[model samples]
Target: MSSTKVIYALYNDDDVLMDAVKQTRKAHHHIEEVFTPFPVHGLDKAMGLAPTRLAICAFIYGCIGISVATWMMWNIMINDWPQDIGGKPSFSYLQNMPAFVPVMFEMTVFFAAHLMVITFYMRSRLWPFKKAENPDVRTTDDHFLMEVSVSGDEEAMIAFFKNTGAVEVKVIEKH
Candidate 1:
């Protein structure tokens, strides 16, 4: 099941791509992915990358979408079909919480933007119309890719991507 393979390195300079991810993780070499359009500072702690809870699961799915939109507007306009308008009252959240604050801020930004985009596409295995495993198409147009997935010494990972300053290297399979 180790078929999805790639080995690419094309660097210009973000300090030589952060010293080639700290020398290919100190020559242990297991970097699976890295692509750069921006963000290259420290590169997720040199690709250890274990500090994402997805903003605490989008703040607990935005507090369960503001407690199910304030309990479905307190069970439909304060207990089913209640319409007391200007007189207020009818589950008057302290005499009108600014008209339920734009439906609880659009249900907490629609449950924290659709449950933080389905918890970042199920913590980034992605799904549904998933046709991208881009080892390189010049890594989305400018090239800063540094993907590696070697098994053993494939010529010591092609001489550690040309001694950690790879301007271009390629080994591809996982199409």
Candidate 2:
């Protein structure tokens, strides 16, 4: 199998990493990926990544959850077996909506949270028993790694990363 050569720039501080990312973009370098010990605020923006649409998916999931809960409660309390509890009759779902509010809210939150997590994992290509794709162990500890696809002048790319406050730079063949 043919392998692609890429540059990996390691930084010690998140701030420095952020600046390096900005400079790399300014110089028109295409960043492949970035690995960090923790989430870096605005890193995605620096890397020119588009905003995530997970919130929209969460809203849709929440709507589905509430709809399911409403249908289930209506079927159980109103359609299947009508009940007279606390001197209240289950004649109309609208009239009994206040009583079902708790269930609706719980279902909405549950579905939104759970489905959003699943969607995020699926979108990220994360799966059970997946092998780790991290390039360096230090990225999981206290370092940040920036991966850039090399196009021309490997030596100049190394010099550019070093000027951007990278602690170390290496070129490796990525499969």
Candidate 3:
């Protein structure tokens, strides 16, 4: 694969970075990515990013959890070894559903949370022992980095970033 020239603009404050994002969008610049130490509220809207669909995945995972819990409980209590526990006969799953509410709720929450984390990690291409893809290490601590792809006019882009409160701006050849 070939490398491309990209400009990295480092900002000290998230407020300044947010403003710069707005100005960059206004000036019709295509921002490749932005890295921040913490989540910056409203930055997604400013960057025109689409809303995440992770909630849909969570809902599906929850449904799967509930179904599995119901099936497992039915097999254990009603089919495999039906027995009288706490003076209640394990005759019908529907009749004994109230007793299984806590289990069902816990399973639903457990599946949703665990599966969501796994899904997020997979989607973001994060894995154990993998090297960080961030261009600047400072962005993980106190700095914010904005990457803008440049086809021409590197000097103008650097000047634009400096004008927008960038602490440092440099053109990098991204592999």
lDDT of 2 by residue, 10-116 (tens): 99999999999999999999999999999999998989899999989999999999999999999999999999999887889999999999999999999999999
Compose the digit string of candidate 3's lDDT tens values, residues 56-136: 999999999999898989999999999999988689998899999999999999999999999999998899999988898
- Candidate lDDT scores, in order, read 0.81, 0.96, 0.94
Q: Report the candidate with higher TM-score, 2 versus 3.
A: 2
Q: Which of candidates 1 and 2 is the stronger one according to lDDT?
A: 2
Judged by lDDT, which candidate is best? 2
| Local error of candidate 3 at residue 46 (angstroms) | 1.0
Per-model TM-score on C-alpha atoms? 0.35, 0.98, 0.97
- 29: Cα error in model 1, Å: 5.1
- Cα displacement (Å) at residue 149, model 3: 0.2
- TM-score, structure 3 vs. true: 0.97
**Candidate 1 Cα deviation (angstroms), residue 8:** 8.9
Q: lDDT of candidate 1 vs native? A: 0.81
Error of 1 at 9 (Å): 14
Q: Look at candidate 3 and give me any clashing residue pairs.
A: none
